[model samples]
Target: MKQPLKVAIVHDYLNQMGGAERVVGVLHRMFPEAPIYTTIADRRKLLPELQGADIRTTWMQSIPGILRRFKHFFWLYPFGVRSMDLRGYDLVISSSSAYAKGITVKGDTRHICYCHTPMRFAWDFATYMEGNEASPVLKAAARLLIKPLRWWDRATSARVHQLVANSTIVQERIQQHYGRSAPVIYPPVNVSRFEVSKEPPGDYLLVVSRLVSYKRIDLAVEACTRMGKRLIVIGDGPDRDRLKRLAGPTVQFLGRLPDGEVVRYMQHCEAFLFPGLEDFGITPLEINACGRPVVAYRGGGALDTVIPQVNGLFFSEQTVESLEHALRSLTHYAWDSAQIRKHAEQFSEEVFIRNLASLIEGQLSSRNPAARPAVPALAHKKKGAVL
Candidate 1:
């Protein structure tokens, strides 16, 4: 039997329990022996699955309060990721939305990037700074930093042997920004965690997301408020306070809740409100898995999962009026919960792992021209498999 290829996994950071962290968790499970490299890590904030992993952090980890304020150290992350010694590893896989893909490795070693998006801040400078109420001084500083950061982002794209995008939008962004092509691999959703509802849907609208500005949770709050619709807002972040102030009496802010409770809300809600544009939004599918339809913005990743009058309804614009119209249409139409759950099964954890493992095996086979990988079916097992 051939020995397993020496592998190393790198992630941008380990401070949030978000979609990116979940991807890292799945990768860790697939490569249990490989150590995870990151710029900074706060074990207390990570998911339980990642808490016990051998997560090695760089010198930046020693910075005070970096756990809560790592974004302030953005300029240092490129250097921090590149400085890690990954020379001996046969393969380096960086699960990144940002600088993690800049990890330096020998020419002979394979490096695959599961790019969520080519550093959103670097590429979408105007959009990234839009919702922030940063002081003029901070804005000026960011404007100056973006130039060098853009150069660094473009320069580092050449390091990856292969690039895997999470959605078609991200795949297109990679080609447009990096001048590179990548396959689209939808992020995994733990479909088994949610069950189809036994009863009919509840009266309230549901918004389960980090209370952040760009996420456009404000649209949901404002729309539901104007319409006098009861909306349950779950999850918390820096924008929590401002969101609370914008919310009307009908909108209830639940902050963050345990996964089980979140699933419970998904099962019972009238429809899941996904107001933001995501590279590949996983929450909408998670809601679908619980047999709930979604009212989503008709752009970005929502286009991939939601079919008009199928799994969910989509609003053409990212404004309160558009979302309100979609909500009205959602109420008038009947939804098929079983079909929605079935649609979600395509993006399950099992499917993501199988497709990903197949890609790794293929890359390894090409490198070792002398011997082809044993499992050919692994590559062709599923249709609609991208990267």
Candidate 2:
């Protein structure tokens, strides 16, 4: 009998977990036996599926309230990532928004990286300088670190045998940040979870995110308040109170909802409003998969997922004024719910699993040309059985 595949997966910090962590969870589904490794894991607030998984982490997890001291971890992450025990796995799959791609791998093992974005602060420091969030001293330090980290980020690209990006936007980023080419495989959307239905329209629009300073939920609140539009902000973070103060009486806070409740709101909402520059906005895809159109900030993954009239409209700039214009213009056009769902179907979980299975098979087959893989026509089972 053939031996089962042995895979080791690595990621960056698993603290304050969000979409990228969910992507790792999806990978777990494909390789159920694979043990997960990362820099940090906060089990208290993590998804239930991740509870008992064999998640190995760096010594950073030993630090008390590591997330509160998160800024310090960045200084130690480089060394922490290099220290992982990756000596025995047949395959290494890294789901990275940061330095996990730089993990040390043996020459005999194959590697695949699903890059979320190439360590944004390290590679896109110039663009990030536009934000006034960081102090000048810290910005200067980040700028200084940029060149060296960029070199390391690029050096690691050659370590991976295959690269898959979440969107064309990230495909471009892969080229610009790492000088590497990667195929676009849109992240999986659980299309079946959302019920695409018409309902009594609420007075407010929604902005769902982690409420980080970079996410710029502040801009969304400011724009909606200034425009006299009602807004419903979901998800909580350090910026919640700050964002709430900026919003008007028309704004409501839903905090974080279960995956099911969020979808119910998505199905019944007037339209989903996604206002951040995400590596790939899986939430917007989830919203669209629910037959709701999105009003997205023009940059990032929105460029690939949203078509102006087909499913959603885009704001040219990531500013308050621009999003206001897009929000106002969105109501002028009508979007077909069925077409929106169809566009979303193209990025469903089934597609991701299929593509991943193909990529892994291709990698293993290339390693062993003498022994052919099972026929694709057999549907992963023995042939000559009734359909």
How do the residues 54-105 of candidate 1 rate in per-residue lDDT, one tens digit apiece? 9999999899877766666778999899789998787789999989999888
Off by over 4 Å in 2: 125-143, 257-261, 370-387
- Top-scoring candidate (lDDT): 1
Q: What C-alpha lDDT values do all the predictions have?
A: 0.86, 0.77
Query: After aligning candidate 1 to the native by TM-score, how far in Å is the CA of 270 from where it should be?
Result: 0.6
Backbone collision tally, model 2: 0
Query: Which residue pairs overlap in candidate 2's backbone?
Result: none
TM-score of each model, paired residue for residue: 0.92, 0.87
* Span of ten consecutive residues with least summed lDDT in model 1: 370-379
lDDT of 1: 0.86
